[model samples]
Target: MLEVRRRGLTTLLGGTAVGWALAAHAQVPEKIPRLCFLTFDPGTLTSNRFGAFFEGLRDLGYANGQTISIDYLSVEGNGERFPALAEECLRLKADIIAVSTTPGAQAAIAATRTIPIIMIGLGDPVRTGLVGNLARPSGNITGLSLMVPEVATKRLGLLKDAIPGISQVLVLSYLADPIAPLQVKAMQEAAQPLGLTLQVHDIRTANDLPAAFDAAAREHAEALLTTSESIFVAQGQRVTELAARYKLPAMYCFSNDVVDFGGLMAYDVNYSRVIRRAASYVDRILKGAKVSDLPIEQPIKFEFSINLKAAKALGLTIPPGVLAIADKVIE
Candidate 1:
């Protein structure tokens, strides 16, 4: 009798343990959501914007191999490769697609209308016709915008401030990017008021960058302002080196100019903040929130970063007032 009582107690404890295990497993879903990330700039998985965004995802309770799995594909400055990459992501049947810039977004949208598409660090989505409007993006696409037209003018103004005698401003842009034309228009409008000669140059490939800089120098551009596209950001070091080599005062639209060893002043959106905000969007979507219902967001925190070291190298003195207002001054 004693032996039977002991056996019965053991059986009851084993059954309770099994029941608890089943309940826990039921709470945690079996299949993890797979997210696909496509970028125009091909950089290492540990660095650059994509890496930062990946880290952001982990902070939001979605770590790779745990809750969410990511399939990352990069085009590495090849526009032609975007379509094929987008198609591959769709073929994987990604739960959500995260893309950078206008071209990448278009490719993802074309690949699948049903899957939610999130864009990071893109210019005016409405003007580019990526979405219907900012307040109500009535589609599967919604994310962040960098506030282009106004931001363009501010970059020029900052360049002028850096170089006081700046009579000519050279603008470097990517022709294929839809935001380029709008940025150019804003730069022209700002130039008219300041009496600054605006020389716009189009660059399609990385090899063309040196020649474009040479042209800007030959034109006697007193200052330079480059756009914040993936192409230029990918080649941040090269662009900054050239700008310093030419001794031309250059302002960029990203912190990479200062942090990644390039350019002088960057009056642009706070990128980490943008990526963190993107994580929030991703989290909401994963929790069954509609992408269309999550209204697209614009950056509220813009950063002004100045490299005093780069400024000294170029023989330019940064105005004290600008330094006073700068969010970061790299000595």
Candidate 2:
């Protein structure tokens, strides 16, 4: 009878050990990292603009919803919504916040001091106080700089080249975007050397766009140059239509804007490439790298795209010199 009791006790002990092992296994949490993407452009989540980011993450062995999760918040051209959207990301306990544009970066920085922020396509982070310096951010923010001034100069040069004898140019900028003033200054500086006159027209909302176009017409602007602001990019189709309606040849910042949206020409960094590089920052941060250690990067390449159909619609001829150097020409 003692032997029987001993065997029963052994069995109970073995069962308890197995249960404990299972419980311990259940308690071991999965180490899936969470990323929050904050953008002023609403179409980022749904369009190919942000798809490049996911593709980059995949290249780094991170598959969304499987190995990692992403929470997206877009203000959709409403600058006032940025702070609240950033707070929402904080409430969700995001491990890292990836911000696109200066306004989104500003909102994210204001929302959390502990969470790491990866800024993409920001203009003059140092001037805007988003970072101490490009080499060492010294805070929880670092990624890619759009190098807005250089790009603006290049775009204006292309515009001058495409439309020789074009004297007056209208700059359509969003007044709400912090980067707008800097971009306008860069354009003005670029215009002076080329003997091109630039008139600044600030649009505060989508409703203000029509009035800005009317102002452009009243100024007798020869060509239109739109800033690379989220609000302006979000209204690309409208801007293109208005430029056509006003009979003004327009130059855009992104090649896709010209190739896809029917703008006259564009000279800027390939946004897809920049966003892809930004994903590397995310990967490093997830692997326990500090934001301050990761230095800010700038685009190594810029592309020029021209729409032949758009030029035709504007009754303009593309100089052979311009067409010869274009990376992409859409007919």
The list of candidate 1 runs beyond 4 A from truth reads 1-29, 257-262
Model 2's alpha-carbon lDDT is 0.85
TM-score of 1: 0.88
> Which candidate comes out best when scored by TM-score?
2
Per-model TM-score, in order, reads 0.88, 0.91
- Cα lDDT for residue 263, model 2? 83
- Which residue pairs clash within candidate 1? 257-262
lDDT of each: 0.83, 0.85
lDDT top scorer? 2
lDDT of 1 by residue, 95-201 (tens): 99998888889888888988998888689899888999888787799988888888988878877776778798878898688888888988898887787998888
lDDT of 1: 0.83
